[model samples]
Target: MLVLVFGYLFGGAMTVPGGGDYREFLLPGMFAMTMLFGLESTVLAVTADTARGVTDRFRSLPIASSAVLGGRAVADVIDSTLRLVVVLLCGLVVGWRWHDGLGAAAAAVALLLLLRFAFIWVGVYLGLLLKTPESAAMVQILVWPVGFLSNAFVAPETMPAPLALIAEWNPMSATAAAARERFGNPGWGEQSWAAQHAVAMAVGWPVLLSAVFIPLSLRRYRHLSR
Candidate 1:
């Protein structure tokens, strides 16, 4: 809500290049942002379990190792879905409407959830790796740069050419651009390859991240005994 308030307060002065309502552009990015922020909570949750020896207890049970991590992933995804819904409602209340059909809007939402799911593994790995709950603060601090470095609050075009390229390639940027495309909202619409193929990049980024992180998480989980 604080982000929304600040966004609106400053949004009036911003203009989306290629012409579209800033709120419309901002809201989709906000959806992606909400999902990105979930990384912090997931890290904290897993870290807390590790700190309290809850994970150790689970490891002692005769359950499949995968279940331990899977359970956490399930709960986080549910929480992320609820967060997404609340943000959607808030976006509506604030006058950000999707121009696309319901089908497109639903697809956009699916993409958002997928992004969250991928990040969950990242959080899980980090949680297992960090020695203490206090260390989760590192991930929290890192989230902001990841969130803002994208085309979430402002278009990448407004950034320096090199920085804009990096932002355009950011997973968050791809998701935001893809979500905007799905909602029939405006985007940076830059000529860069990433900007032109937002949906592909959006889908690809998460899948790729998961591919790398899922194994790392499982490996890390297995080696916790070490």
Candidate 2:
């Protein structure tokens, strides 16, 4: 909420390169950003559980280890969905509307949630690895760079060639660009392969991230018992 207000306050001067309303461009990116922000809370929750011995207690139970992580993932999904809803309503209040059909809008929402789902494992891994609130708080330092380095607030065209290339290829950029395309909003205005294939990248990035992190998380969890 605070972030959305802050965006609205300063988003006026942010001109889209191809000439479109900044709000339209800002909202879809905001949706993706909202999912990214959930990482902090997920980390905090897991670290808190570990710090308080709650995770150990869970491990002692007859439940499978996967169930323990799965439960956290489910809880985070609900939380992410609620956050998305609030932001969506807030976007509507600010006069941002999806110009695409309902089906496309639904796909956009699915992609946003999928992004969140993939990040859940990341948070779980970090939270378990960190195992303390102090360490988990460092995720905050990581979050801003990951969030802002993408094409969320402004287009990649507004950035230098090198920075623009990075922004264009950011996972968040894929999701943001895909969401914008799905919602029929303005995009980063790049003819590059990444920009043009946003949807595929959007799906692939999360899958790839999950593939890498899920194993790391499971391995980290196993080591926790050592």
Candidate 3:
């Protein structure tokens, strides 16, 4: 909420050349940013469980192995959804609107949650690999830079060619672009192929990230007792 308020206060004043309203562009990106921020919570939760030996205790229980991770995934999704709702309501209060109507808007939200879900798997893998809440604290330093380097705060076109290319290809940028288009918000009128087909990338990136991390997380979990 504070981030959103601060983003609106500062970012809403800026506009991409030939783009629509800055606030319109800012909101969808903020939504994507908020979802990405869930990475921190998931990382901390998994790390804390490991650091405190809660995971070892869980493994010793008679419960299904999948239940432990499944429960964490479910809980994270619910928590992320609640956070998204709060952001959405705050967005409305600050004059943000979805011009794409109900179905598209719903799809945009589903994409945000999907992004959150994939990041949980990444967090799970990282937390177990680090094996310490102290090392997991470093994830914060990495996450914020990745978040800011995308289109969440400014148009990629405003960046230099190299930086712009990186931003354009960023997974978060794909999702943010897709959400903005879904919500009928402003875009930087990117001419590149990636920018033109953002929704596909938005969906594909999360699936790819999850496919990579889920098996790794599961394998890591199974090997933890070794």
For each candidate, the alpha-carbon lDDT, in order, equals: 0.90, 0.89, 0.86
Candidate 2 backbone overlaps, count: 0
RMSD per model, one decimal? 1.3, 1.6, 1.6
Worst 10 residues of 2 by lDDT: 6-15
lDDT of 3 by residue, 1-226 (tens): 7766765676567766685677778888989988888898888899899989999999888977578888998999999999999889888887788998999999999998888899888888888888888888899887887798898877788888888888898889999999988888888888888899999999999999999998898889989967
TM-score for predicted model 1 compared with the true structure:
0.96
Candidate 1 clashes: the total is 0
TM-score on alpha carbons, each prediction = 0.96, 0.94, 0.94
TM-score winner: 1
Across 1-226, the per-residue lDDT of candidate 1 in tens digits comes to 8878766677666778888878888999999999999999999999999999998888888977688888889999999999999999988877788998999999999999999999999999999999479999999687998999999987788899888888989999999999999999888778888999999998999999999988898888878989
- TM-score between candidate 2 and the true structure: 0.94
Stretches of candidate 1 off by over 4 Å are: 7-13
Each candidate's number of clashing pairs is: 0, 0, 0
Error of 3 at 44 (Å): 0.6
**Highest lDDT: which candidate?**
1
